[model samples]
Target: MEDINLTIQKGEFAAIVGPSGCGKSTILRMIAGLETPDTGEVLAEQEIIQRPSPDRMMIFQEHALYPWLTVEENVGFGLELKSVSKSERKTRVESVLKKVGLDGFQSYYPSQLSGGMRQLGLAV
Candidate 1:
């Protein structure tokens, strides 16, 4: 974590790679505002990130979905929180689930889905 500096272009597909316990998750959390740094700053889209932005989303490693909510509900939870209309939420949920190759599992609960399927819930 010494003097780390990174830059990503608009269309870049970048990833963080490191050994376990080597600060990979730390970096992500700091950028995502889930953790704070004693020094240095985390910026996104030219803005200093002081807190999590609604426009920026993080798919936690824990999946973080309510077990009682179905796949579609979990994926659309953010939109729901934003007070998006029911029809629009439904449309977006379906579209994102399909984008993640989960065309037929919208009705599935988190417990009923595989781990990878649960992870796809965050793609929305």
Candidate 2:
């Protein structure tokens, strides 16, 4: 995590390569706004990131979606944070869930879903 400098252009794909314990996840976490740097600031779209925003999302290696909420609820959560109207959120969530092939499982909780299904939920 020492003096790492990088710039990823819009629509570009990037990779962080290193051996174990090299703080690669740390860098991604900072970029995802889940962690704050000790000194330098993190910016996206020319704006300094001071805290977590709904605009910034990352699918963690683990199933990070709420187990208490159903699939539809989980997908709609993002739109809800943006102040999207209830009906619009419902429609968008339903569309995304269906797009991810989770249509019939909208009422299912995380514990009821398989590993692949859980990952799909994050993508919603």
Candidate 3:
């Protein structure tokens, strides 16, 4: 990797548009702590990026929604892994599903959603 410099402050929305295999996803993965750099660093809150944390999240071009999980299940997947409580998880999953326009489809599986819907599901 070259010495590429990038930064995004809180509440910022930045897009790294690029052709296929041009490292856009690589950069994102690195920033998400999914990939490590050989000769550089990734910092979050002034600390070096180490591994996946709730404070940082990533949604790839290919939706990572689990096939067997219902829409609600997938949206709350992360919080579930973190052992969030039932009511809190339900509230969060519902809120995000509504935010992504999947409010009525929470019981559906990824296989039932269109590509865009799946992408939205992954995003939330």
Q: List residue ranges in candidate 3 displaced over 4 A.
A: 66-68, 75-101
For candidate 2, give the lDDT.
Answer: 0.86
Q: Over the full model, what C-alpha lDDT does candidate 3 score relative to the true structure?
A: 0.88
Residues 1-124 of candidate 2 have per-residue lDDT tens digits of 7888889889998888999999998888888888999989888889987777866767778878988999988888878889999999888888887777999898999999999999989866
lDDT values of the candidates? 0.83, 0.86, 0.88
lDDT of 3 by residue, 36-96 (tens): 9888899998999989886777876777888999999988888999999989999999988
Q: Which stretches in model 2 have alpha-carbon errors above 4 Å? A: 65-70, 73-92, 95-101, 108-114
TM-score of 3: 0.67
Which window of 10 residues has the lowest lDDT sum in candidate 1?
A: 51-60
Q: What are the RMSDs of all candidates, in order?
A: 3.2, 3.7, 3.3
- The total number of steric clashes, by the backbone 3 Å criterion, in model 3 comes to 0
Rank ordering of all candidates by lDDT, starting from the highest: 3, 2, 1
Pick by lDDT: 1 or 3, better one: 3
lDDT of residue 53 for candidate 1: 68
Per-residue CA lDDT of candidate 1, range 1-124, in tens? 6688988878898999989998898888877777777788888888888887665666778778899998888888888999999999999888878877997998989999888887777645
What is the lDDT, from 0 to 100, of the residue 56 in candidate 1?
A: 62
Q: Which ten residues in a row have the lowest lDDT in candidate 2?
A: 50-59
